[model samples]
Target: MIVAVASGKGGTGKTTVSANLARVFDAEVQLLDCDVEEPNAHLFLKGAGIEEEEICIPVPEVDEVLCDGCGECGAFCRFHAIVSFGAKPLVFPDMCHGCGGCAKVCPRKAIRETGHRIGVVGKIRADRVTLIQGRLDVGAPMAPPLIRAVKARMRKEVPAILDAPPGTSCPVIATIGGADFVLLVTEPTPFGLNDLGIAVDMVRDLRIPFGVAVNRVGAGDDRVHAYCRDQGIPILLEIPEDRAIAESYSRGELIVDSLPRYRPLFEELARGLFDGGSPSGNRAGYRPFKSCQGRFRRRENGCALELHGKTCCGLDNRCGKPPCEDKR
Candidate 1:
């Protein structure tokens, strides 16, 4: 099972929860930190030397010498990465989507595909968890590619937890794509509620199962609980605001180690997601509610049952059609 721990805004203890949960479960787990632009999970899991691999993206490189100054390449590019205006074509590598259409349409074959290093993916093992983190090259505008590379390291049979980048954007979507469930970690502040609403909409649109974890539970008002109750979304777990927990976190100690009692809480979280119900029950097999019929599910055939009326597998599952809303 793949569970992605994410927040609409940063610093809500998403990484803390992810790391501790992996430790408490003690299963063959993989922790993928998909926050490519700013990866800090490695700091929490120290002494794990990350094996690095370069991440590159294809970019169009135009050979002016072979060009007949044809505008076919320019006209074919919808992103306008390549433009021909009476002279040698100008190529904007950053704007390119690497579709290869420009090269395909070029009569002289002047355009050739080349790779540009965008980031690096590192695999590190600590205890029972394998932590994969991606670091984007400085000034690189793209993050989805690196996030994809980080996720590619995940072993499907093992329980994997992805530390997603904060905010509802392409990077976040990429990170949470194949997750069986998403745990949105939030504080009880007004900003938290506002951003949580946006994150709820994003996950709802993707038709993924989700639950909420209220961190620093007593720091603010009860509005978050009120919203969750109103929306019928489950409040999975609550982490109280404690100075000791804060001090331990500051000292790079795992929550399960600092507060041994809370180890069961993290383990319960894993069970709740995998069992598809509240952790306080008889531990029976989980059954999805009728209302959640359209949510994504992994089939026995190793394919994903997308709500878009199609079964998909591999990376192609990413492009499955959007969910069709039920008018009822």
Candidate 2:
């Protein structure tokens, strides 16, 4: 099972939850930090170096020898990465998506693909977990390609947790794609609530099972709590605002490591996600409501049903289409 931990904005404890959750799991788990642009989970996990590899993408390469000044390649380019002028095409490697449309449409066959280095994917070994993190090259505008490379290393049978980048953009989408569930972390402030709605919308559109985790719970007003209640989004686990927790974070320590008392809380959250019910019997949030028609078992002991009409039919992950709705 793949569970993705994400947030609508930065500094909301998204990676904090992801790294610690993986820490709670057994050695079969893999902790993937897909925040390629600003991957900092490695600092928290502190794994021993295992392996590193350079990941590259294909960009347009011009073979001037086979060229004629055909505007076809330029015209077919959607990103405007290539524009032909006077027997040559200006190539902007950064803007290219590497669709290879220009090369296919080129009548002169002057354009082909060449390797472009965008980032590196590194593997690290913690005590019982393998940490995989992707780092984009400095000033690299695109991250989806490298994010894809990082996700490609997941093992199908083992449980994998992805610590996605903040926000609900292409990078986040790329990171959370094909996940069994997503745990969105947000604060209780106005800004947090605003972006939380956007992130919730994106996950619902993707048809993935998701829930919300409010960090720094008491620091802000009850509006975020009220919002979750009104939306029927379950409150998985709450981390109260504590000075020691803040100090531990500053020193790059895991919350569970610093405060072993909270290990049960993280374990409950993970169990709730995988067991088809809310953690600790709080089933008010997004339920895993598996469709009886899908691969999931139908027995009440094995399957959890939802109050809504949601069903999973092996279409997407849940029902081949979006199952959750945002009435709020």
Against the reference, the lDDT scores of all candidates come to 0.74, 0.75
Candidate 2 residue spans exceeding 4 A from truth: 275-328
TM-score of 1: 0.81
Residue 139 of model 1, lDDT score: 85
Cα lDDT of model 1 by residue, 180-271, tens digit: 78889998899999999999999999988887887876677677867876687766666777787899899999888878866655765665
Q: What's the CA error at residue 69 for candidate 2, in Å?
A: 2.1
Q: Model 1 off-target regions past 4 Å?
A: 75-80, 275-328
Query: How big is the positional error of residue 213 in model 1, measured in Å on the Cα after superposition?
Result: 0.9
Q: Which 10-residue window in model 1 sums to the lowest lDDT?
A: 281-290
- Residue 89 error, candidate 2, Å: 0.6
Q: Which candidate gets the maximum TM-score versus the true structure?
A: 2
